[model samples]
Target: MKDQSNSNNDPIYYQEATTLAKLIRNKEISSVEVVQAHLDRIAEINPRINGVVTLMGEQALKSAALADKAVSSGEELGPLHGVPFSIKDAIDTAGVPTKRGSKIFEDFIPEKDATVVTRMKNAGAIPLMKTNIPEFSAHWESDNLVTGRSLNPWNPDRTPGGSSGGESAVIAAGLSPIGLGSDVAISLRGPAAFTGISALKATHGRVPYTGHFPQALSRFWHIGPMARTVRDVALGYSIINGADGIDGYGIFAKDAAPATFRIPGQKIRVGWVSDTAFGPVDPEITTAIKATAKLLADVGCDVAEVRLPFMENTDWLTPYFNLVYGELVPYMQQYTRGRESELHFIGKATMDYPLLNAAEYVKAEATIEKLRMHFAGYFQEYDVLLCPVNPMTATGHGLNEYIVDGKTVSAYHVMTATAPFNMTGLPALSVPVRLSSETLPINIQLVSRWFDEATILALGEKIQTGSEAYGKHPIN
Candidate 1:
């Protein structure tokens, strides 16, 4: 750990938070310098990234003062002692504006921190600011009227990926060391892939979703950590985990698998995805997949091209969309019925959901059940399923539709990999592995059984071990 004589010397912000915590614990630095350095970093980089919209400079400084006092007086320090952290705008922070990336409620401030936020604070993580998100937390794009769009630090014209896009933006840009992001589907992973950062969407119910947006209000969403490294992801999860006691869909936390965290005798069997699964991905993305497969195989993993129905049931896409649109109908209607001046045009798309007839709902339910059964059959053979979190790096910003190499498609098309897992309630992760041809970060990863996040993350940790530049610097 660096001493206070040069506590804030690290040019890389990703290392700042953990280093700050270590310094404070070892009396090499005070909490105040750590907090101020982060605040200063936010002021420096956030303008370009827009990752942090609402700054808590004053509150963060105050918290740092208290934490240092405690440290000096020999009081106990939590796991995240005096480390500064940012919350995705979708998550509540007491008295802080969490606009959920829409103009309709841009000024909405909550009276209490979301349960996840509260738990993180209880661990002594300093509240630096709230990051950005997409409107109503819909779509994978993180931009909304509230804070505009969070641009990719790698290339400003490209998007950072959505929903949790802002969180990825900040971490990738080195604006904040770590932040919270809720993933309904590929929200976290999309940006993680595009930004080349570490993130994990824990099994639903393992992480509480209380006090967040409509996505968190429902059962099909999860809140997880976005960080520059796997250890950081594990640290963030270790803090905010367990039941928050408010979300009705949130069950009590489960016991940890084992202290050793090593599958002593079992060979890692990962079903790899080659060129054709869940729609065509960019060749760059596929190249990363093949490279990863080779690495795993070289490392003694039983890696082979095993196709497990990722795109076997394209006929069911409409039904899945119906289920999604149905679940989001109320929120869509609320914004749609809202005054045009009060809402963004995207929210208007959601407004028409109420008009769907009874037949549509019935068909959607049947399709979902069948899809779930089909996916369950795939898991019977493979312990883990490797795939893309997104097909390419972050796409162009502000374009409702995407045109990939002369092929036009809906903006939502990129999210195919993630949504299917959510549809089946399977646990998935998007681990940052390598950068794309454009030098944008690519997240290469896999999914496991419903409650088997440990296996997915275990493999992610292994893959991350081979990536030297994955978290080199969000800032040039």
Candidate 2:
């Protein structure tokens, strides 16, 4: 890991996507310039971080040139006009290799873009590159047979949180201004927390999951925006959200147009939790959660420490893992049956996941409904539930277990704070609040009721305002 504090000297690379759009629209900077700068930054920084796996420099530059031409013609521009953004390899990109972090589909390239990618392109954001991920996106660390592992930008020895780790690492290092990432359990929030960036996993169906790899786990899957700033995340989410008429889950997505900016008229009610359900939270992380509650209260919001009994008593993880592995294990077996030796550590471990019987699976589904009702009941009283994104800060790469708060905990325990939201299909946003004693970032997960992204995003913006993590890049 090179300690190039001046690696992020170029202001263009660090500017938010929202700012880049304005700069390009106002002719202060050309789209080509911005695109080229990001591509150059990727060239310089990607080798050390291994975040971006495939580059589209030539295609991106051509697209940028066309964008510049469109500007010259004074044509109508979209909200993200002339901005460059990245896509996770698990998502399809037309004519670009989306390897999905697996050797099986290493050469696979989709002829059509995913719904989210199409929406972003239509909004005038150019696809820059594909980021790394855990093989089949089934692991906690972003290592795979196809692209190896994505290292944390904060410290190369540590692992960036999995699946969307590459997206978080690049955004945190200023290689890309904004990007798209998918979340199953903690893919979006955990990585964003690990890298000191902001990510939004909107209500499950708020964004379509069409064309994403391993389509088996679509029930718990969500695709959303990841960026360094809340405003940029809001901008990206606004463009990519809503039913696309393709995904089954998308068809039932509630209309967010009316409530896009609807902040609660009353004093915002915030409930903070630290150690009730989420096991073995770091002491520094608990302090940060309390500090965040104070921050909310100081801002005149009705903030209090509260616990959800359902969370404490019920086993959310069993049902979540049952559903996840129920679909994913079989899907993975088809590809790894004959060539298991080619599998990466995470990929091989995924194969060992136990599959539930029909009765057990049906029971798991019922439990999910029960959990949803529990959250719905709680939300009727409180507008937001704030908690730690992960029990510990970013950990060193390739560890199967972690010692958090002096207790040895399984690697899957980190997902304790994040998986419940995925099961309930609620809107959750990860915002960096403070740094740990080791200078690692500590993020607070703000979850809102179904289709109530506005509440969490509004709260995220307020939390972001006081965050030292904002505008501070790890590479710098």
Candidate 3:
């Protein structure tokens, strides 16, 4: 509806959230100008990617006006003051229809904000719209009966990675600077890698998970920040990290202010792996990860190869699916009580699956603790673990198979490198390094000890300093 182009043709639409906030705070640009520029970009490009299914232009402009007034009133603003952000459809936004890319909840609107959303608003970030996701967010691609599908901005024929795919798509397409997304089994990390963006799957309970729907698998599910830069993730994490008194899983740090937000000065220990128990990683992806590790090592980091026995010879699906059906099936039944036919395909499949017994669930929980302890010992020798976020890059839409180094693997195999951290409830970050041979985005995963998101962020920042992945947009 408006022309948002700059005179020199530099794409202001793709500027990072922190840059936009600084401009607004310094009066170099108005909040309305920044929000309107992004709204214009979304209107222009979202049709191709289908990243943003809902439009909140009017509401965003109103909020931007209020932010400008606050700046004019000489009030001290939060870190993200006057920045525009999007919310994954799975996360609740007060008065917004959080349809979750499904038909059953197509008409549903939340009366209150999610804890993460509340904190973002408190930090002066305005919600521009709701991004798309899979039906009930159960798949690796963001498509459903409601918003249809979200395509990768890098290549429309491919997916942007699922659940949080739409958020990553919009950010890569310059429609939004940053966004909020949830990860249960590689949802955020996978999409972030696929779309060439930076995302953090914060340690469990680091960010409160209150006010989200389908509270099944709450133990491992996490809501976190997806941005163009790793520093933005650290800033958003600080604002949203804390107990809200509603989420039973939320925790308070022992320190007055967590040091994870601060940059460390000493040389850090790092470990890397191209593949886990999952064999046959793409050669190009391995090269990208090795390049990233070498960059960190060049900057005075003690980088080496590290292996954990807990990650070998084991199928991640066994425990992950067991926990999913054991915990999520009941919640699915509660929602689809009498309307089985109304359920999405994945939801119906989940409901039809044979749930694990109480003993099996107990065993599954015990196995999770075992893997956690093994990784804990592994981290004792290294401050962070670097690995491939996915065995390959983004894949074609509506497809279920992938060719990873001449081996045909199912879609679930893409989660092999990521779901382990989800099972352990450890902090993991996905940082883009370079483009694959196919010209698709390739990213490296960074894992830290439980509740130690700071180390990963610090290390990601170091690599980012010498990398070309940051702010490289798909649509100029």
Candidate 4:
């Protein structure tokens, strides 16, 4: 396998994506060279991480050459001019296979680019490769029959987090400085936290999701930026957010950005809650999150232990799942019913949700509405809230089920902190917080009010500095 060291010996690999974009603008380095560095990194490490499944190296180089021509000709530069990025397999790319990490669509190449993909290209970001994901982008883990499981770059023995697992793994390993990830609830944020990358889920409807498969029908799905640093995420967000002809949601404004990616100075109101209106957290994860809250307190942030009354029971979680997974049955029955051999086990699991009777649907929606209101009230006073992304860090892949703390759990129990946000449509992020006992990366989640994603990234940056995931390179 080729190595990154040959191509990426300079400090450019460590620079923020935005910083590299400027270097391209100034003609200090050509986009072609940058693309080569990323391709080399992917070759050297991707076999182990399994992050990128479909490489567009030739296409990327072609794009980079064109970018060089533009610069040499003194053309006006786009916001992300000459930067390289990848996409979760779930997002479509013109003439490229977007398998959504399923065997069923391994041969499926799209005739058109997803809305965000088109936008990124227009902004001059070179398309690098297609990252991996679970089948149909259903489960939280990045394992499917087609591409296999994505291992954490930090430790091969652990998982990288999913369905944006490939996106997270690639960024954490320093392959591509930034990439796109879709999150119905926690896909973008969860994997970021697990892999120790920086990411932003963005406000609901901030970025268009028009060519994203499966979540195409999802009202709550969001396609946003995932990168190694908060500033990189912001730069990507600027490039990707825009109205698409097919999307009902209007394009996001280019003007909005937080003053800083990391919070600065005087104590801001911060709230900490280990348990939630969802499932229980793993003791290790819980302790790590609480410790982070305390760390922030030491940094002079006004930290308080807060609670959301609605999270005290599980009555709402079942329906929330039913509404999401329940809706999938119809799509699969139409798309995959006669084609079972084309699907993975989790795709079958997703199809099983609609089997729930109308009684189940009624119950799920009723509880979801109440839970949404209950949590909305909590945002009245807090600037941001912190919690565990999942009860546990990345675990072994391919288990049909898990035995969490000795109790038999459903396949979906691990996504405890994630799905509830889908129910409420509130923006949240899983910020890498601290190292665990095994020396793996563990993350704390931050949830902000509707349209308040700026605060989430700002606070996440502060935590990143303290955790040391900010400057530490996985390949180093």
Candidate 5:
């Protein structure tokens, strides 16, 4: 597809949120014009990708009219004034149905917006629609009985990774400029990589988790931004990063500052890892990650190969799953007390696991702390860690195993590379690096210390600006 992003006369569908905001604020484009452009884009593309499950066309245009009035009335405008963004169906949107990709909550509509959604609106972003997600966001692809499957714009046969799959897909397909998504595992980063976009999983509590489903796992879960560029992700992060006083996890980290992008003048210490102890990566993905490292090195960053202790096992998988089931299963059981049969199959299976006792839970928590400290020490020497977002690129839908180097492994293996950072509650940013021979996009993840999202974002922006693959649009 020819790139529409650089077409100045075109309607605002493919423009970056940051760019759209500037045009709207300066009266180059009315907010109504911008919203209509996206609505028309959705009309054309949503049938194929199914990325936007529930559109707010009437509501969005109404809001856009008021936004234009404000702009013409000489009222102060926020940074994202008049830009339209989508929310993952898993997050609440006041008066909008948040089905969360399950029949159980198909009719459920929230009376209040999620903290992140409200922040976006407060910063002058308009809600365009509720994007699709997996059942309770527990799967690898964004498919559910409620909203069906969200297809990858790059290749319909492949999945846009979940639970932020729809968010990533819509942004990549040019239906929306920016989006809100949450991640406990690889939801945010995986989908961004799969769709060839950018996303950030800020430190655990940096973005409040209020008004999201299955709120029991707040420690590891995070809500953040998915966009077409690293700077836009940073823009969204700056607006949403803060304590909302409702989520205790968010309240504890009141001092954490938002990260921004700046080209580095001096050499930045970067630690690079291509393969973890868990298994081998797709050779092409490894090559792409190393190429990214060399790109950073070419820009004067000091890059070196590094390994972590117990990385062969990567304590994140087993113990993290244990804690997840231990805390979440009971909560899910109680939440679906009367509607168990309507729950998604994955949700039902999650409740079937025998719950871990208090001691086991503590042991799992301790293991996570140990992993955190190990990374804390590692960050003492390195500014950021560059790694692959997934061992392999986006694959065909509904498969339960991945063939890596001719060996079959559980499909969940993709989470091995990303879940570790979630376990450590660190900030990790994923940006597209290169496309494989199959023409699918691959990304390298940059991870920083507990609250140092700035360093990682800066490095990610450097890689993004220097790579030719940056901002390459997928076929719609």
Candidate 6:
């Protein structure tokens, strides 16, 4: 990460979305300037990274100009007014081609914005572009037949973890201040960690899922915001979270404002674990998690090293994969029936996933319930759970397996630290804490109870304040 604060040397594209909005509102800068700066950054850096698959420069500039006019007229402004944000291709955008990184839907343009997209625009945030993703967002790396692979901004030789890889790369490279992305397993948090940014996967149903592609596996799917700082992520999450009436799962979602730290004299109880039943973790990652726990404890929070019994004994991955692919494979087959030859390697692999039988499906459902109960019981004692975002740092391009702590493991092992929360539908935040020996980012995940995003977010802000990785962008 390098400093880009010299206005004459570099554009303000690296500033946080919250700061940009304030500058636009106070008349220190025009919305057009902020939007154009980001568009220019995308043009300059995207050629190497291939992160932005669809650029909305023309429309974004037009919208920015209109936003400036509204500001000049003394109109009331939203929190993110005129700030440019990127959207994952998996999420729909009106008048934009949301191909979901597949050739089958390559010509499809959404007629309406997804509920989360609409909420962002309603709050005056301009859509800058549609970032890349795996076909139907089924893989960890963000490569597809439609947009190819999204390389890491820190090192082009490595991957920006997917399926939100494109969004992560663009933001980490200072192409956009903030963005919207979805997660079923590691889509949001993994990419955020790989790219050295902040992302929050709010509790399931906290944000409506209407207008996203694939339209299956709604249970594990979550949509949230990604940015360079925790504050900007909080701002984006606040605006986009809430039910839209169209998503059945979101109907009963509770509305809670973002919480402030200190909690009125109560010490936040934090439980942390570097090693768990998930799988083998890299020693560097383990050290980072332990350091973060120490940081929280030093700051007056009641922190301790802890582990859950269910996580140690239960095989969550088998049930997660069986349940997800059981529904996802069939839903995706409809589009690839005759167009199978057009799919990328990841897409082809997704279609090859085994379908679950009746008994297995029932057992998977039972396991999911048990996981939820386990987390519920754990949360009764701790307010936040801190852990590693991934077992290793960003991997080389096209890697299907990785060596973690000298042990070879499948690439899906990256999801071990993340997908459990997706299954439990708990709110989770990924905050970049340090850079590895190779200068790659290492992040820690902060998870809170269901519908209790405020706790994790408030705690994330504390961790981010001392984070060396926050507010820093890749030079390339």
Q: TM-score of model 6 relative to the true fold?
A: 0.96
Cα deviation in Å at residue 219, candidate 4?
Answer: 1.1
Off by over 4 Å in 5: 1-11, 252-266
Best-to-worst ranking by lDDT = 2, 6, 5, 3, 4, 1
The candidate maximizing TM-score is: 6
Clashing residue pairs in candidate 2 are: none
Candidate 2: lDDT of 5? 26
List the pairs of residues colliding in candidate 4: 243-251, 277-311, 282-391, 319-364
In angstroms, the error of model 4 at 188 is 1.1
User: Model 1, 1-476: lDDT tens per residue?
Assistant: 11111125445355745665787888887778777877777888788878877889899899999999888899988878888888888888889898877777788999988988888888888888888887787767776676787888878788888878888888877677788988776877788888878788877788888888885237778888888777678778877777767777667575544222225686767778844665557777777788888888887887779765547547455667666777786655655464666665556565554545789788777777776787677766667778888866788876767765456767777877778777676777788777666677777877876677777776777888786454455565
Task: Order the numbered candidates by TM-score, best leading.
Answer: 6, 2, 5, 3, 1, 4
Superposing all C-alpha atoms, what RMSD in Å does each candidate have to the true structure? 3.8, 2.7, 3.3, 4.0, 2.6, 2.4
Q: Where does model 3 exceed 4 Å of error?
A: 1-9, 254-266
Q: Who is ahead in lDDT, 1 or 2?
A: 2
- What are the runs in model 2 whose C-alpha is more than 4 Å off? 1-10, 252-254, 257-265
User: Could you estimate the TM-score for every candidate?
Assistant: 0.91, 0.95, 0.94, 0.89, 0.95, 0.96
- Candidate 5, which ten residues in sequence have the lowest lDDT sum? 254-263
| Candidate 2 residue-wise lDDT, 1-476, digit = tens | 22222123447888889888998999999999999999888888999899998989899999999999999999999999999999999999988898989888898989999999999999999999899999988877899878888999889999989889999999998899999999999999999999988999998888999999988889889999999888889999989988889899886544553222225478888899988868689999999889889988998889989988887855688888988888889987778899888778778778888889999999999998998899878888888899999999999988879999899988888899899999888889999877777878889999987778887888789888786565566775
- Please provide, for model 3 over 179-252, each residue's C-alpha lDDT reduced to its tens digit, 9 standing for 90 to 100: 99999988989999999888999888878899776688888899999987787777878888888888898876
Each model's lDDT comes to 0.75, 0.87, 0.83, 0.77, 0.86, 0.87
- lDDT tens string, model 4, 289-309? 778788778877788988777
TM-score, predicted candidate 5 vs. hidden true structure: 0.95
Clashes of 1: 4
Candidate 6 yields a Cα-based lDDT of 0.87
Clashes by residue pair, model 1: 140-162, 141-162, 142-162, 193-443
